[model samples]
Target chain A: MRQDRSSVRTERDEQFHDFVAGRRAALVRTARLLTAGDTHLAEDLVQAALTKLYVSWPAFRRADNPDGYVRRVLVNVLTDERRRVWRRRERPMAQLPEQPGPARDPATGPADDALRQALRDLPPRMRAAVVFRYFHELGVEETADALGCSVGTVKSQTARALDKLRTALRPPGGAAPHGAASHSVVLRQGVSS
Target chain B: MMDLHDRLDQFAGSPAHPDSTQIDADVARGRAALHRRRVTGAVAASATGVAALVAAVAIAAGGIGTGGVGADAGTGTGDRTTANGSVGASADGAGDGRVRLVAYTGAQPKGFTIDTVPDGWFIQTDDNYSLLLAPDRAKNPGPNADPSRDPVYDPQSFVGKIGIMLQSKDAHGVPEGTTVTVGGKDGVLVKSRPAMTPDGSQPPADGDTGWELYVRQPTGIQLIVQFWEGLGLTQDQMIDIGAGVHVHKDAAQGVG
Candidate 1:
């Protein structure tokens, strides 16, 4: 019996290792979006999620959609961290400057600035919904599953978040920013259904 | 002129070249967590009532003794030497290869107080919720510097600095880390590993070896004192600093 248990543990460990090796980069990518370009926080979130995933490997491996399970865990960790930070009531840093436009990131150009700021401005759960639906290209149902929210909530949050992004990306003097025409059309398609 | 979705995809960016260090750290931390869970489970299954509580405390003590840099067993006299032969017990000043701690003379912050701070570090920001300490360097703006001009040096950035605050309300039941004693009160210490990529965007990599020590206050709130990895403080020194924390009654309870 002990041998059986040991062998089971070994098998699970090997599977967990493979899962981590394969999914870590993508996980970090998603986390980077969730954290709105805070690389360290993104990495920390991913590591923490991965740690929890490792502990629940047997159940995770048995799931019908393991990738969805992984996404859920990652989102959970991110929101949990945010909740802790909020609960502590001591913000490490002030909110990004209350400028009209997005904060500058050296890695991105002026065009990408607005998108980054728009995402940062969203509440954590709302931002997660948008990232899952748009960046990860997950459907609303999948996004809702990953977010542990109702599909209706996902739609509402994504729609509201996209509206904010649209406004933020709009150019001064009421001119359409780059790709505004096409994006407006896409947003119509994205939110209507 | 990219579509918004395309723009977001670009903004999210591609993952960097894989780092084995991260994967390895994940597995190691996972295993440690599993081990802890199993130990706790076994303890719960084997005891009941006060016996279980006593066992839990023993387990915590044993875990800390084995998991951390071992209990200092020092006199708490402010003079014992650490493994590196630096004064481990002294919170008053730094020694060779040791972080210096000096009596904090700044106006008392709203939330917390400490008897000693690392040498040359100053209270950069004093809010009801947190106290920030930054090194006294030219580049770092003095306390209450304008954020408009020096966003990087803004105390709220919390980058490359020490932070002291009360633990979040939700963290009350969570076991923070290895147990230790600070000024005769129980404390917990958690040390974070260095980031795989030391990019400046990260909080601690600029010079922090992340260490967070939580000392329980008489009011039952845990006062958390965290150091940037860059400070290079030994565990003994961390305890010494934690020993000096006083959570003011006015310190607001963290919201959750």
Candidate 2:
């Protein structure tokens, strides 16, 4: 019995290690967008999600979709973290000048900073839906499963999120004569893809 | 016109990957956490087995129903109501009759008691905060509630919650409000916009208002009772809740 338990533990650890090694970068990228480019918070979210994944390794391995399970856990962790009052108290203001200033990598250009700020301004769930649907390129059904919501909710949230992003990123002067038509085409391509 | 879709694609493409060393550290941390959880589970199982064995032996010895210890002892019970109808019944019977203040000896925090809470309100405490009194009508999505749909951090969901936080000294930096006496202790009552969102974003204009009473004990401990105005609780009622607080003089600081 002891030997069996030891072998099982070793196998589980090996599988979890491999999963982490292969997917850590992608998970971190998703976490960054979810946390609005707060690198420290994104790392914490990834660590928490991975730790939870390790705890449930046996069941997760038995499941048909391990990536989906991990995605669900990641979203849940981010949600729970946001609900904590102490964490809320410690969070920096949304419109703080220092945030956009320091996050601007000279190499990445100004557009990246503006996009990050726009994403940051979104409500947590709206932002999560946008990230999972657009950034991760998950189907609406898949995003719904990961978010533990119905497909209808995913569609609605994604639409609203897109609306907000469009309003935030709209050109200062106004939409060009052909901008709306081109934007629609781009949005359709994104949704279809 | 910049396409939002392209912007999001570019945003997602940004590589913020942790270094290999950090990954290794995270793996080690995860392993340690798993080990700790397993040990805790094993310990809990062993304890349960021993307790069952002891109970069996005691029963065989004809010690079945002799009240070894009263689990509810020192836990406050329903009693008389004050003139203001603040607290009257046991916490278990919140809706039985007039509100009854009970001594809260919960694991998270001590030395404070809630006098009056809306019917169907439940209390949860996991930290130094005195208690989180959530409305009964709120759907408890349990631990597995989906972030995308339920959005646990939505401020509207917590519109009626009353949170009591205990701080050792006046470090909260709460802007001073009108001075009021609560439970024979002088306290400052301050009103502010509801708490910011988890990401430090301002709540919508229509969000609930926040009322806080910071009462300083003679022992230098500060007891803060906070509630959202969306619950429609009156100032007198809020004050009465603060006034009904019974702080145990012998309670140690940060015991929670």
Candidate 3:
């Protein structure tokens, strides 16, 4: 009995370690976006979610969809954290005016910064829906399931979020010129709404 | 000219590897949590069995004659007792029916107090800024309960929860909710159905409800009381929980 228990523990630990090693980066990136680029907060969210996933590892491993289970846990943690008044009260230093500007990668520019701000401005649930739909490329039903909401909710929230993003990112003179390269990218991405 | 989708894609660009040190620490925490859960489950199981046996013996002895097992069970704290001995049903008139206020002071801001919550619910103060009240059915399952069959850890299992936090500096832009008086102080109350999404749009969930009260205290402390409707708790009961909240200056300062 002791040997069986020891081997089971070792097997569970190995599975958990492998899962975290493989998925931590992706989960952290998603969390960073959810937290609007607060690396520390993003890491905290990811860690908490992983811990929760570990706690329920037995059930999750037996289930047919462990990835979905983990994603749902991440979404739930993000939503709960966002709802906290103290968390809302605490602003990242990047958001402070007196602080130096956020360090931008060479590939990123003023437009990307504006887009990031716009995304951060979105409501928490809408942001999750948008992230799942656009970034993770989950289907509408899948995003709804991840958010524990209905597909209609996902569609409406995504539409409204897209509208807000367009308004926020629009150039000085109306919409981008027809057939502009970026416009083509948007069209190809199928989020032109 | 860039579309929102492209921007999001760029924003979510390649996932960078996380720090190995952090991962190790997190894994350690996970292992610790697993150990704690196992220990807690064992203790809770034994306690439940003992309580059941005691209740059965008392019933056979005709010691607890009336009110069924629930009333008799209420007199015993079972596993729900806190260190402060604030877990029992209230004898005070403030309680409604069997629902008594379970005084809670854990995980709250300094000077924060939730004088009472309904009985028969499990209260958790492990979170930094909230007090979660989950039904007995929702807490970690005991020996007799199979978690595989009865998953209680989901958020929906919670009947009601109260969160108290210090108001942020940039809270002026918050939309004016319904004006009301709580604990002799003026506050704004906002009630929404299907709970407002993070972006402030009402979702399509018709049954879920959320109530929030933002009270500006005389001491420049902004207290927010938020309750999610669950476990058959009415709006009035949620408001009552908010009204009973008391905060003092000394206790309100330096909260995380």
Candidate 4:
């Protein structure tokens, strides 16, 4: 019996190590977006989620869609952290700044910093919706499932989030001419994915 | 113009130096957490077994003595209402709503000092944030349980325990109940649903009711002494317990 327990522990640890090696980067990236570029907080969230995952590894191994389970834990940890007064501090810049690319018209959207700031402005769950839908390219239903919310809630939150992002990204001159069209296009892109 | 996806991608730029050591750290932390859970569970189980054994021994020796308990120790479904209309009842045939608050002869925990504890109860878990007074039969989670994560943290372990802690930082609005006094300071004796039931996150299942005594300290921090219905303590006893609770400087201030 003791030998069996030891073998199970070894198998669990080995699998967890492999899971971490294989998926830690993607998880960190998703968490980065969820925390609005706060790389430190993103890392903390991933670490916490990984720890919880490890604790429940026996059950986790038997479960299907392990990635979904991990993502759900990650999002839950972020939201719970958001509720804590001690962790309610401001988010710092993402560790990796945006790379310089072809310049876009300033009137069309906000700069990278502006975009990060806008994402940070959103409520935690709303920010998670935006990240899952846009950044991770998850379908609305998948995002809803990850968020443990209804699909309609995901749609409304994503739409509202996009609206806020669009508003925040809008240039000093006026609303962008294609704002409405862009909104519809974004929703369609999120849904059809 | 770049779409939302494109912009998000650009914003979530690749990490400059993704530390390979993080995986090791994650594993270590995970292992430590797993160990803590196992240790806590084992300790709680051992305590439960010992308590059952002691109870059986006491029953064999005739009966359990309530040395410091109140005089109205009738073994019945003692359900009564306070004059102020707060729900009062008892469970486990302990007593009616009324219970004698005897001097808590146990070791005083940090953050808060209690002059009185309910009969057959002691400070099971204590921290600078809160103090948990648990009955002798409770499966004590030892002193390591975090009160900040109460109700959700080992739900069954905390059931029927009296919790004393400061009001959360974001706690506002006067709780509706009868006004009372504790240690010469104004307090509120409010009846609330048990934050956690044995089943799960559900509150006060099977008509279970709890009590909360919100006593205002001189420093304006309201101390809350919550009584689980299983204790069957009356509001007056709750206030008596609240009166004995003295907050110390070491007590950590609550956050939302």
Q: Top TM-score: which candidate number?
A: 3
Top candidate (DockQ): 3
Q: Tens digit of lDDT per residue, candidate 2, span B1-256?
A: 5645566665655554456676666666666667767766797799899989876775666554654323332333434332222333433445555443344333433545555555555554323334456654444667766635643333223344676656522133445687887777888877644442212223333333567777887766677677655444545556777876656643333321
Error of 1 at B53 (Å): 12
Colliding pairs, model 3: A123-B198, A123-B199, A124-B198, A124-B199, A125-B198, B101-B117, B102-B117, B110-B251, B110-B252, B111-B251
**What's the TM-score of each model vs. the native?**
0.52, 0.55, 0.56, 0.54
**Candidate 1 on A1-193: residue-level lDDT in tens?**
3464323445656776777788887787788789876666787888788778877888887899988999998888886676435222235333333432213443322335656666777888888987888777789899999999899999899878777776777666666656554244154245442
Each candidate's DockQ:
0.19, 0.21, 0.22, 0.18
Clashes of each: 9, 6, 10, 0
Q: What DockQ does candidate 4 have relative to the true complex?
A: 0.18
RMSD of 3: 13.1
Better of 3 and 4 by lDDT: 4
lDDT of 2 at B19: 64
**Model 2, residue A16: what's the lDDT?**
72
Per-residue lDDT value at B95 in model 2: 56
What residue runs in model 4 are displaced by over 4 Å at the alpha carbon? A1-9, A86-111, A176-193, B16-20, B62-256
Q: Where is the poorest 10-residue window by lDDT in model 4 chain B?
A: B196-205
Kindly report which residue stretches of model 3 are placed more than 4 angstroms away from their true locations once superposed.
A1-9, A86-111, A173-187, A190-193, B13-15, B60-256
Q: Write the per-residue lDDT of candidate 4 for residues B8-96, one digit (tens) a residue.
A: 77666554333557666667777777876787679779989997986676566645564323334332234554423444543222444
True-structure lDDT of candidate 1: 0.67
Q: After superposition, how far is residue B42 of candidate 2 from its true place, in Å?
A: 1.6
Candidate ranking (DockQ, best to worst) = 3, 2, 1, 4
Reference-based lDDT, residue B64, model 4? 53
Winner on TM-score between 2 and 4 is 2
